[model samples]
Target: MEEAPKTLAHQIGGIQNDALRFGLHGVKSDLVGSHPLDVAHRSTIKTHEDMKRKVLANTYGSAFPLKMDLDRQILTRFQRPPGPIPSSMLGLEALNGSLDDFGFEDYLNDPRESEVYRPQDMHHGMEVRLGISKGPVCPSFV
Candidate 1:
C-alpha cells in the first residue's frame, strides 16, 4: 500500500518530464492529434446536419443525435501545461517523500482517536459482518 503512492508519483513525474521535453522542442498544440479548428468545423457541420434531420424527421425521426464534442475531447486529451514548466517541484510534497516522521503503522492504531480513523475499525467491522475473526493464512477459499 505504501508503494502505491510512490509508484504513482514516479509515473506522474515521468509524464510531466515528457511534457516538458515536448514543450521545450516546440511541439505545437495544433499538430497534436487532429487540428482543433478543423475538428470544430467538422463538428459544426455535423451538428447542422443532425439538426436538419431532427427537424425534418427524415431518417432518425424525433430522436436527437447523441454526438460527442470532438474538439473539446481532443483538446482535453492533449492539453499541455500552459507556459514554461516551473523550476520548483510541482505538488510532490504531498506524498511521503516530504514527511519526516510519517509512518504507515500510525494509521492502523493511532493514539489520537479523534484525529485518525483507525483501520482496525474496518478490520473488525468486516470480521463481525462476515462472522469470521481473522482471514485464513493461505488460499483456503479457492
Candidate 2:
C-alpha cells in the first residue's frame, strides 16, 4: 500500500498569471502608508495643538466653571401654596367643638366601648350562608 501526502496544499487555479496571487501590490502600499510615514501622524499632531489651546483658554480667560447660589435662586423661583381663608380657619374650630358636643370624649373614656368595632361573626356567617357571589363583605364586617 502507498502512503498519502501528510501536508495539505490548497490549489487556487484559473488565474492566467500566477505572480498575481502573491499580493505584492497590496503589501507595497501598506508598507508606504504604515503609521510613521502617513497623514495619520500629521492629523494627531494638529488635534493635540487644538486641545492645548482650549485648555489654556479655560484656565486663563473668562471660561471659568460656574458657581450658583441654589437655595436663593430656587426660593425666588418657587411659588407657595395659597394661604387658608379666615372662614376655613374658623371651620376647624367649629368641627373640634362639634366633636365635644357629640360626647366623643365620654365614648373614648368608656372601657366597654374601647373594644374595636369588628363584625367577624357576621362575615363568617355570610361566607357560610351566602357563599362568595354576594359582593365584598363590608370592611366593617371584616
Candidate 3:
C-alpha cells in the first residue's frame, strides 16, 4: 500500500536522524573526556612509580634484572677518566673556560648520543631473541 511505504520512509528517516544524533553525542563525549580537567583527573590516580614502571616496561619490557644491568653498564661507561688537575682548571678564568669545555652542555642537548640510547625496535627484538615470552606467563615460568 502507498500509506505503508510512506510510513516505512518516515521510520527510516527517524532512524537515520537518531543515528546522526548518536554520532554527534559520541563526538561531544570524546571531547569532554579529552579535556584538560579530565586528563588531570586521570593523571592524579597514577603515581611516580606507576609512571616509571610504564616507562621501563615500554623501553625494556618486564625484564627488570636485565634492564638494571644494562643501565649500570651504561653509567659505568660514562665515568670521568682519572687524571690530575689540568692547567685549564688552575685559575678562575681557566676554571670557567674548562667548565665550559666540559661537554656537559652538548651532553644535555643531544641525549641521543648518550651511552644508554636504546632504540625501541632493538630492545623489542633483543627481548624476543632472549626467549622471554610475551604477556602473562604460564605456571611453568612461575
Question: What is candidate 2's CA lDDT for residue 90?
Answer: 37
Q: Give the Cα lDDT of each candidate.
A: 0.39, 0.41, 0.41
Report the Cα lDDT for candidate 1. Answer: 0.39
**Which candidate would rank higher by lDDT, 2 or 3?**
3
Cα-lDDT of candidate 3: 0.41
Please list all clashing residue pairs in model 3, or write none if there are none. Answer: none
lDDT of 2 by residue, 47-129 (tens): 98577657756887634212122333443444322221111233333422433455554656743233553323343334533
Question: Runs in model 2 with CA error above 4 Å?
Answer: 1-37, 62-142
| Per-candidate alpha-carbon RMSD to the true structure | 25.8, 37.4, 25.9
Query: Top TM-score: which candidate number?
Result: 1
Worst lDDT 10-window in candidate 2: 80-89
**Candidate 1 C-alpha lDDT tens digits along 1-142:** 3555533322212232233222233346436677789999999987986776576565654433333233334434442222222122322332213445466645775333334322233433344335454332111111
TM-score of each: 0.22, 0.19, 0.18
**Cand. 1 TM to true fold:** 0.22
Worst 10 residues of 3 by lDDT: 133-142
